[model samples]
Target: MPLSFFSGGGETGDLVRSYDWTSTSLGAAESWPQSLRTTVSTLLLSPVPIVLLWGEDGIMIYNDAYSVFAGGRHPRLLGSKVREGWPEVADFNDNVMRVGLAGGTLAYKDQELTLYRHGRPEQVWMNLDYSPVLDEEGEPAGVLCILAETTERVAAERRRAEAEAAVRESEGRFRALVNASSDVVYRMSPDWTEMRRLDGRGFLADTEEPSVLWIERYIFPEDRPRVRAAIDEAVGTRRAFELEHRVRRMDGSAGWTFSRAIPVLDGGGRVVEWFGAASDITERRNAEAALAELNATLEVRVAERTAELQRAEEALRQSQKLEAIGQLTGGVAHDFNNLLTVIKSSTDLLKRPDLAPERRERYVAAISDTVDRAARLTGQLLAFARRQALKPEVFAVCDSVRALFDMIGTLTGSRIRIMTRLPPAPCFVSADPSQFDTALVNMAVNARDAMDGEGELTISVGAVDQIPALRAHPAVPGAFVAVSIADTGSGIPRDRLEQIFEPFFTTKGVGQGTGLGLSQVIGFAKQSGGEVMVESEVGRGTTFTLYLPRVVDGVRPSDDSAHEPLMDGHGMCVLVVEDNPDVGTFAVQTLSDLGYRTVLAATAEEALTELATDAARFDVVFSDVVMPGMNGIDLAREIRRQHHDLPVLLASGYSHVLAQNGTCGFELLQKPYSVEQLSRLLRKVATWQRRARIMSQ
Candidate 1:
């Protein structure tokens, strides 16, 4: 039978049968050996690349895989000997066949071969294995070959090898660069206990040992704990570590260094080691220390200079004060001497019995007038000294200025034009209404004199939110009512502007001015919790501004309560406490004149003892604010606690006791008061006591 009858009838099987193999040494397929027929059928049916060479000629019979591997020479080379089919690699195939026919086996991994598969010689790589086939007698009969192409895989391996070579060369260059740098480069174990220097020298180069603690030896003793903590933190967090600290240098000298490092993690994200660098910063640290020391020294010098300047300023102030005192003494002595001469001459004239009644009356009147003038002079001096008692009240500044307009006009006269600019609404201030009027009148008179009794005097009132010029004045910060008096006059000289407020520092000729006007204005303003400022130009004019703290309660406190007709004391008993004998005698006499019975005490203790003896006998207790043993304010407090019904009146003439401990809720009666003022106060207290007794009954 033909080999076609034994073929499987697939594409490869059909190709085997249709081909004329009778011309070959294998001859007709029907005359082939049974062993050869069986091997041919097996080769044609296999999916892998399989081929068989039969007998001594090595005629090829291959499967579909092998046919594809054969390329364009498949069908023709199928019936040819291996030596003839692969002419380009004929020697290699010849050896393969020779070894197989001798009952030996051969194998090649990625073996190189050349063939004329597509009518052109081509080089290829393959994995090949050849084994001998045996006959029924167990002797080698033919060769069986198995092969797979490995061209793509072999090319990939060659590219990978070239890339690895480039990486190795780059690593060598990186190591060389690190070795050349001045900064130290190092690597540490995962826990940072061991360090290996990559550069020639490291931050710890002073240590010669190769132990794990080699780096620790160079760390400053004080900085070792912090450095070790940082390393442990980096390893724990698997993050970068950085710090600046002092270190011991290789030359056994102290130095500063900035060190930084980052962890190298393994495949499981666990820290494997650390890579780091350190740079010396000893010079920078030394420079910073030197700069700090220099700054401290400069500060000490500046403080010494400031203290010296303050001492010089204080001395200048003292000299100015002494000059002012001398001026005040001269002015007071000159003015008082004139008044004393007039009084002495008038008294001597009145003493002559031969004087006419009218002449004697005129002389008496002259003496009385002299006394009044002296008293007025003393009052002005006290006002300038800020020692005069002020009765402060919440009154509208506009109202006060408006009421004083006619009076101011009378003082300035017809030659001077008095213009008033008052606010439509009342601008209230907490101050003494009488003092406010006096200050305004005093400024008007000054303006009149400056203008030679003929000029425009403008008095304007307004509310001020803040006064920057008066910030250093005694007035507290807040809203204020400013009463400004401006004059179109000859204006004050610039040199005398500051001296104008000093007592008796006037520029007027002898007997023309007392020079206490502006000083009184300043004293009143400061005592009333306010300030006074003057602005004057040599050619233009002068403006005096009085800033008084504004009050929210706009209603003016009425004096009608004190204006009531004075009542006789009706022999009501009075307790008088005075430290001075003369003052006590005067007080007792005044009370007696007011028709009141009086009891005198020298001190607050004596007064308390008097009150304790007969609290009911005394209708009122008039005590001096300052006395030895216990002050009047304390006495008044004790009287209130013991006898709540008794009315206590405090009296002071610039007492330190009143200055230190205010009035202590008792009504204050300023000293040097007239009999009318005393009578009025006593009657008011007596009336209140009578009303209280009536209510209690």
Candidate 2:
């Protein structure tokens, strides 16, 4: 062994002298190359945090400054490889060692990486300067690095940014308030059902006293529905209300006003009333109307000018549009996710041959409910443009695909390999949520068949601007999420490619396949405003891509209600009023099954007749909102009038009346509800009513 020569490395120098370098990849210190010895001696005396990563193994040697930076790692890290030493950043260090040993130098300013200091992981930023250390033969042997920590500097910058953001937000809110102000001021109830006060400023009729029919009195006949819709939307969200619509003027002629309203919240943050103002925009509207007519006639001339400008702005606008996505959720985004877990789990459990009937029924109900919910749970999602059986939801493509991995593995079997090429950021799409899963599963199964139970399948998801003319179909240009499933297997023939999507088209012999898989994929794609594409090379592989229209502003994430087990209801009698005989029967039977006394009424009039018989016996009236005569809302109002103490619950799938008027301050359950949802809501509403009665007393 060489004599003790690490005299200048402080504590590290003595540690290096006593270290058993023979156990390490670097071997004995006595047999070390002359250049490494010189490099080590030079670093040992330096105050800066310098480390020498020697040889292919990146054997680490550092000065006292670097030792202090290592914290508790110190002496143990002395002879260890750089990768094994900082295992958290092993990949990063591997790349560094690779470049340095190959005689290449690297420098990174404010390099951010997580490091384990003091035996716990901490994010750190460092300015790293790396260069190769040469041997006596003038060949690169190892990497030498100088590191300066900048974590604190980065944190300080972040703090400054947060403070700046708060100032900007305050300014923005102030600007909006100032801009939305107008001349004629008004106040309305939180529900906008009653106009509490209005100063029309001589433009229109003033309402000094509260009027329940203010909308009919103030808004023009043609504009009443639009006005009510806007007001209801604002009330529902408790947000600022803004509309520019026609209203009845004092002179009885139709005029326009830009009405802006803000919810006035109490100290507890509940909206107690709406404070609003209106600016007469009739003159501005007439001028805009004339301008619109002129523009309509000059479309051809302006189109050319617009086209030229668009060409210049295309790239910037495209990038800006993508980056602006930070600004915006559709519930049920055919972007639908999170529905598969229940189905998969329930189905797996159902495979047991000896499960008890009640237990089996519960599992069956879970699956049944999940499937039904796939159709029912619309949750502010875009309705299918074409009225179809599709329950389109906006869902994240990457996340949905990830959710299917376990199921996909079961379908593909152990012999086949599964891989994914997905972008780090989530890509979203609009399509039927249930059908999305079916299409992917169909493709995966097809891939398995093509591979004969062995080989590889890759699912790739990404955003694309345009799809080239695929098969016989014309090219489609739009933002789309492309989910490509590629399989390493014998591929389809060129001539057969066009016919693959045809229903009942199959190459399998006998009854091996139904041939509806690819058909479903194509059908779903077309319905979703997207397309399915196929690429194949004989004896090589096949790639099937299902393109879906991408949606950037996905549904806002809402916490799903915790579905506690279905509870047995007390003997709370329900008067089930459904217009449909079938639905009424189902509700009555379901209520009875769940330990509730049920009385069936096929019409709103009939329900009232039943209620008139013994209103005291019926604890609640569970009535459908949309019926032929009187309707559910009118019936609810009537019930409230006659039986002032009895509770009423409304249900509907798509009631334009409910959509415009909201729940009318009554409890409402949406259609296609499962046993759990129905049961839960019933118990909840009943309990609330009981508590309310007690509070009132």
Candidate 3:
């Protein structure tokens, strides 16, 4: 049965007294059926915080549940006013009554209500709903309420909102930082189909296009696949990524870009996206290219300079070799000349009235012929060795070429025809006349040999403002005197052209030629600031072109012959030391013939013994550089110990060894000398002695 139809004993206060059970025949009837009474009573009395009120009057019938909810309000308080029953919540009850009486359902979804129930004080959030009861006339009466507490759910919701706000704020800061950077910052999906990017320059802007569209349009076509792969790798491994690629700009130009990225991962360790920045590096790349090109150019220049240095070193080596040859030749000539002096003196002594006329004449003629041969040999040696120091004077090439015509006639032996083409005007060059003559003779001799003694040789001298391809001759461009020697002889082979200037490299057969001729000519020309060029073909002829730098001054005459006069030593006791018996006897004889009283010492010990035995005798000591026991220089020193003022002359076959000995206060004489040179050296020594005596005084 519904609670509205239930009646207990008799209708109490505010009850509808017209109801049949409450008013008809039993105002206070207890004769109701026990089940009905029990059912009605239970409906009105069971507990669950239910309260029945009769307007502002009181609780009409409060259940055990309502008494428990009220925390000590008794059921005996029924029919009492609600303020007397629960004074503490009088204001709450009045507000609820007003809402219910106005016919509105007052619902609280989550409302916190505080109450002191049985001294257990606490707050409970409840979902409360109130519904009003009606009288028989349909007037609003008491209200019924239903409530449920949800404090935990409300608190949980508030905590979740706070945490979300914090995460959003942190993400906003990160986005700001990416936008403020100079590089283009971006994020991408693992497949790279979707992109999120932050424009570094546009962080401050209020709005801009999405990063995804920007990358899709701007990524260079060629680099897109590679960039995607890089991003995918970073995502899969959750590692950092770095790559360089080209970006196609909006204007269709490509820019080199360097990108660096780090992968962002979720809690499951799966890649979510990639965060990266790409910087434009086109300028740096261009600079590196330019630097590479410059370095290559510098390398080429250094190689060229090194080649030039090597050439210069070769030239210096050649000069030193020639100098060495000269020294050797000069030594031999000195020794030979000394022997010649002895022979000549002996012949002169034999020519005296003591001999038969026919025999004397025969000796004279023989000596004369022998002297001529020796002189010729000396001259050839000097020329080949390049030892005869030139006395260079400014001379015209035209005059030199003209003067060499007669010499050419004699040297060529009429087998080769000589033609001269002289320059119309004078062309000056600094050179020795004899050297120029010798150079001409050599060229003519070579030509004659090339022609097999029967071809025409043309010698042409001309002034050139500039040489023909002279700059290509490994020399600089300048004015030159071109003396071209053209021969119609058997031509030189093309392969042999460069070798012509190399000493001892000759095409002529052994014993017929010494290959120093052209080499000497080249040396002389270079020393004179000129260069030599040769053009040859196998069957055709050869032309040796000499380009000597031009000079301004004309020919200046110089003394060609300043021969030393024969000097007889003035009874100066001299010491001669040598290890070779033939050389020793020859030197002693030569000195004896020169009127010097001589003493012979074959070694340093002998020289010292001779000096000790005859302390005040010798005025000069002459010795060869190398010997068996003691050398010449040491011998000279020992001789000087006894004769302090004595002049010492050191002779050597190899002149370079003499340079190392540091000859101070001593004179040096290369061997193989002429009688005249011996006489001159003796006179010089006598003069130096006389000067020394004066200085002592």
Instruction: Report the Cα RMSD per candidate.
Output: 14.7, 36.3, 28.5
Model 1 alpha-carbon miss at residue 541, Å: 6.1
Which regions of candidate 1 fall more than 4 Å away from where they truly are? 1-181, 201-213, 220-226, 237-240, 248-252, 266-268, 292-389, 393-399, 406-417, 423-430, 442-455, 462-482, 487-570, 593-595, 656-667
2 or 3, greater by TM-score: 3
lDDT (Cα, tens digit) per residue for candidate 1, span 1-697 = 3455465736777778877888788888888777778888787777889988877888888888888888898777778888887777888888887899999999999997777778787777899989998887888899999898897888778778888887888889878878777777778888777877777775544534344875567688898889889877877777899999888887788999998998887899887788988888888899989989998998999899989998998998788778656666667777988889988999888889899999998988888778766756665676788866666788888877778889889998999998888878888888777778778888888888888888898998888887655435443568898888899888887777777887667776555456788898988877777788888887689998988899876776567756666668889999999989999999999888878999999988888788778789999999887677888888889999999999988887666455444576678887656566788888778778889999999
Model 3 deviation from native, Cα RMSD in Å: 28.5
Best by TM-score: 1
Q: Give lDDT for model 1.
A: 0.81
Task: Provide the overall lDDT of each model, using Cα atoms, as 2-decimal numbers.
Answer: 0.81, 0.81, 0.67
The residue-by-residue lDDT of candidate 3 on 222-266, one tens digit each, is 888897788668666678888888776435676777888776779
* Model 3 residue 522 CA deviation in Å: 3.7
Across 370-429, the per-residue lDDT of candidate 2 in tens digits comes to 877565334212122122335457889888899999999999999999999999988888
Q: What lDDT score is found at residue 434 in candidate 1?
A: 73
lDDT of 2 at 62: 93
